[model samples]
Target chain A: MIRAALTLFLALATVSPLWSQSDLKKLSDSEITAFDSKLKSRSQATETLIADFRQEKSMEMLKNKMVSKGVFKYKREDKIAFLYSQPMVYHMIINGQKLRILSNGKNQIIDLKNNPVMREVRTLIAASFLGNLSQVGTTYKISYFDNKGGVVVVVVPQSRQLSSVITRITIYFKGSNAEIERLKIEEGSGSVTEYIFTNQRINTDLTDEDFRIN
Target chain B: MRISGLISSILLVVSLAGCSPLLKEGIWLQNTPFAAGNVPYVYDTIPSTQIFDFTLVFKKSEVTGIVIIKTAGAGERRIVMTSVFGMTFLDFELKGENIKINYCIEQLNREKVILLLKKDFEILFKPDHSKITKYLYSSPDRLDALEQGNGITKTLMKFTNYNNKWPETIQIEHPYLRLSLLLKKTEYDPESI
Candidate 1:
């Protein structure tokens, strides 16, 4: 039961960036493709990325917003790790199909080959950071919106299965960096989890041992 | 002949069901007044909503997350457990004896697991003292144990009072399922709201 719940939560992973919703307009098809290409090229150029992240989770029913801080690391191809410092010490590393989670000084590694939900989560996390936005077009209906800050990429799940749990995922990029400055995931139950990234160092030297799991 | 055998077995089991309790060799207390302040998070006398850093260890796997428990009213409570990554694992609503599963992950959708969790939380919040057939007082622990049982299963719940009225820690143990839950009250931050 614990394993099931853990995997399901991991599948709905990632969070928000704060931006105004008032001064936004939907982009045309041509604009969407151009932005997608720009993001794709930017990701291809990035070899490694390291950032400090602050996650804020808000629910309409909850009295307080849940705040947590962590460090995020992503290497070329498909190596990603999130090490949380505040609240508690938790480390999660996703290297290819293997996912290693360390919580409370205990470690457990899970293979994502058998679980379709986890596979989709891997894809979503990768696309959110490393780009390849158009590759997941079949699973998510991509829409582009222009705002004063930069661009907001609205991704809605096409499948009824995923849509039932997660309503939408909005990725925010500021200025011309094309990096994900913020991400917000809206649940069907009126819960929103947002992540804000800062102090990003792109194309830095990150070794394979950084994402290793024993 | 088969029907007679089944009836005999049932009668024997029923007769010997309450003969032994899970908690053994302790003084049974009588006329111990049960108050609202005795149990943790039962009523809204002090702050209805509570957030805790929860950790569950089962077999070889261990999962840690944040659990937010809110008391809507007397018998109505909402429990939501979210991962450290901000994804929700379980969302449950309890109204009296009936429990509504607002949302549960597919992995934990088993009837046995769900029933166990429902019973666990119910025992934590409401704690039907009327159903408790015996109250065991252990001199070593300096705590009174509430033993509630029926023909099939038995459960024991113990509360440790940190303050003058309310308990700061609650421990629930189910011998049959080998399940134990430890709930501790965490410091509330007003600024986080």
Candidate 2:
């Protein structure tokens, strides 16, 4: 009897958890509406998002997983700053009209209108987080998939210009409030960056200094 | 006719002088273009995370990113620089003598800019030993190589603080192109996390 129990335990241990994860099924119209409504209502209550995030980057060039850890702050309307603390301190922020990058103690302000590529990227990140995937013009072909636990929305860029850099973006949503669990960005040049959120506190009050560009 | 013959002879002598074979003859070997001052490091091909204060001089703009170099793997040498936002600025591979660009953003993807980038990496990674006609050691830590051409391109490399056969710092000066790269070392291990 002990031997049988031991065999069963080993079988459970050996079985991969991947099978248990969501298998991304087509959501019905009602399901999509429900998700949209849930996102809209929750985003209303949640004015600020403060989360400790882990970013995993894999490329053809990287022999090992290029892992980077950082903190992310997001405010409604349009304000987000991703500050990478591990390995070094570098900040990428989008506050108001300027797109700012702080690296190696030097700050640079780039106009968003002149650069279409970064403009699209900024759109991609913002729209994905808010769950309003269709807000970023008509350049992307968006699709929605849902599992028992969460929903995965895949956004594929159709434009020749945007497609050169970003191939697709997958946003995974979980929890009843439709919290953004993970975001995966695949580049056309054979690289993937996955941002996983942890310790995500909703409705946290963040000041303007928190999202300062400089 | 005699004066013309004298001029031709002088020209011939000058051309022959330009082709002097002994300029780069001493201890000539493959892959030692400027001839490294000492043995180079045998770093793990996995590539440690290297962050340099990157600057595109003519553009007069500077941004920083982690410069990743994967030398030990198969195919060409892969170099990737990404911002803190996880945005990739430059991604390319060096295969033999040619560089195959996988992707470069629109900002740095101009024809002339791409050509300069190709030349810059070539200068940084590959020594211009083919054009090198002279090599002199200014100091134990400094080595200067002179390339013979209409305009001799001088490459000055200083490796002062080296431990474990690795250069702690590397500086490259391209006279024609007002470009300089300063790479500083840092501890980058992805597996630890």
Candidate 3:
């Protein structure tokens, strides 16, 4: 479950920056293609994405926000790692379709193919990295909204398996080349997990060993 | 002859069924009188919510996750546990005398697991013993949640690692089931409602 959630969350968080336009005004077909191309080109230009993330999780039950700090590394093509440093130490590696977690000094490896939900997440991550926003329609009933902060993309799961666990995912993006500033995941109950990214740096040097499993 | 044989086998099965541990171990009772002075118990912090770094110990293995407990819209309370990967293990709720389990993983859906969890969560969530039975307090600084049946299962859920007006941890254990939960690093927050 942790593998699936972290994978989906990170995939969505990373992909949120791939939408080009934040405006709501109706655009010509040419304008839409041009906008999509701009985001696609910018995303492809980068070899890696390295960012320091401050994740503040607000649950319906707790009054104080659950805050943690971590480093996020996404090497182009197919490898990503998220290492948590505060409150606790955890390392998660996603190489190809395999997910590995090192926690409690024990390492757990899971195959995305064997776990359907995780496979969906794997597909989502790949689509996001490939800048295929249109493919999301295959799994989710998506709607776009215009907000003061930016454009909000609300995705409701179309697949029965995914819907049983997660209700919806809402991402807030801003600017002409929309940068995903925040994302909120709503679960089966009324609980919500909101993630906000900060100090994002793109096209950095990240090595293969960083994504190795035990 | 066939009918008689079938009846005898059925009788033997029923007779042996009564010897099962769950039926023979005695039913769990929830009327423990335990209290803390001015400390924020689960129900005391009413309409409030908290998140804990949750760890569960099975007989053969252990799993770590986060548990979120919040009061539902009604007078009800809900507890949700998820794997670090975000997959949910269970979603349980207590509303009046009715305890509703919205969902739980198949492996944890055993009769023994549910029964013990029901009792442990009751002590953790509804901890107002002002009118219930009383506890044999061990210390001035420590508070405990007590369950009595066969000799008294006085595990740490019975004891609170407490701070001034705050509880740092609630450790619950079912010795027979080899199930234990260490709910640690509690952060007292404002009202979630």
Candidate 4:
């Protein structure tokens, strides 16, 4: 009897992790609607956000993942500053239709009016940081997954232009607060880039000069 | 007869000028081995794998991104370049004398461009020592230049400032295509994280 019990205990221990890993369940229609509204309300109430982010890019061919650490700041209306500090220094700031990039001591201000790629990037930034997936409802097919306490929102591009670049984008939001804890982008090239945000401060004081072109 | 002789002389001068090699034997040399530098052609040390912050400019358009070169196996390397905004421009696999484009964005999907890119990376990753016909060294800068050809166009590749056996920077230039690639190595300290 003791031997049977020991066998059962070993089996449960081995199988428990797999079960926990796959515990993320697909949310029903009503649950998704409620979650979407909560996200929208939280995003609307957020005036400013500042967070330190760690980015990991894993390619199929690479044995070692490329790791980078940076900080991102977002302001209401339209302003973002994404800065990388390690390995190399790269700063990308966006204000309305203007995109300013600083790298290798060179700075360039590119107008995003006719540039489809940059415009799409701007749209993505706004969707992930400023608004919820429901706000980008027209551009993507959105689905929700309940991962234990947190939620995972997966968005696939509805447009051919965007689909050619990315296969899907998965955003993980923490419980109750509708705060984005991570954003994972899967490319058509079989590589994945994941950004994990920490030390998030919402409604923080940020200035336009923070995202200035000059 | 005098005028014809003068024309013949002018034609001969022009032909000699045209036949002269684009890469001068010693004009690019700083030290000599009688004729010029007899330094043995040395290829850059094969690094484990490297990630570079690159800015690629062609014509008036400029793109800044990250480039990762991962050695897949023996004599094989995989190179991936992606934009800062998270769009992949290219994913290429280079095996011995073979190149495969796993993925490329539409903007850079042209035949001529792809051919040039393959040639560029080929020169970058594996400089053909067998095709090298001349070697020159600039002693002042401690740089080594190798002239490689395929019976038609010549390519000049230079490696300099090597730490141990690893080159700090590599420059590859193709005169005919007017294409150049400058690769600067970045130190990866896994323990720093």
**TM-score of each predicted structure versus truth:** 0.78, 0.75, 0.65, 0.79
Every candidate's fraction of true contacts kept comes to 0.36, 0.36, 0.07, 0.43
Give the clashing residue pairs of candidate 1, or none.
A15-A183, A15-A184, A15-A195, A16-A183, A16-A184, A16-A194, A16-A195
Number of the predicted model whose TM-score against the real structure is largest: 4
Question: Lowest-scoring 10 consecutive residues by lDDT in candidate 1 chain A?
Answer: A14-23
Candidate 2: clashing residue pairs, number: 1
Q: Write the per-residue lDDT of candidate 3 for residues A101-207, one digit (tens) a residue.
A: 78767787877576666566555544444555556666787665656635566778887767766778776655466555665777665556665666778876678
Worst 10 residues of 3 chain A by lDDT: A19-28
List candidate 2 stretches off by more than 4 Å.
A1-23, A129-131, B1-55, B73-76, B126-161, B190-193
> Between candidates 2 and 4, which one is better according to DockQ?
4
lDDT of each: 0.73, 0.66, 0.62, 0.72
lDDT of 4 by residue, A34-97 (tens): 8877777888988889999888877776666677778999887678878988656889898998
DockQ for every prediction shown: 0.28, 0.33, 0.13, 0.39
Choose 2 or 3, whichever is better by TM-score.
2
Model 2 C-alpha lDDT per residue in residues A68-185, reported as the tens digit of each score: 7889988876788888897667787887667887766778888778667667767876775576765666889887787666888788999987787788888888956788889888
Error of 2 at B68 (Å): 2.1
List runs of model 4 lying over 4 Å from the truth.
A1-23, A113-118, B1-47, B72-74, B84-86, B129-134, B138-143, B147-154, B174-178, B190-193
Model 1 chain B: weakest 10-residue lDDT segment is: B34-43
TM-score of chain B of each: 0.69, 0.58, 0.63, 0.66
Against the true structure, candidate 3 reaches a TM-score of 0.65
lDDT of 4 by residue, B10-64 (tens): 9987875576564565342233352343344333335456665566665455667
Docking class of 1: acceptable
Instruction: Report the poorest 10 consecutive residues by lDDT, candidate 2 chain B.
Output: B39-48
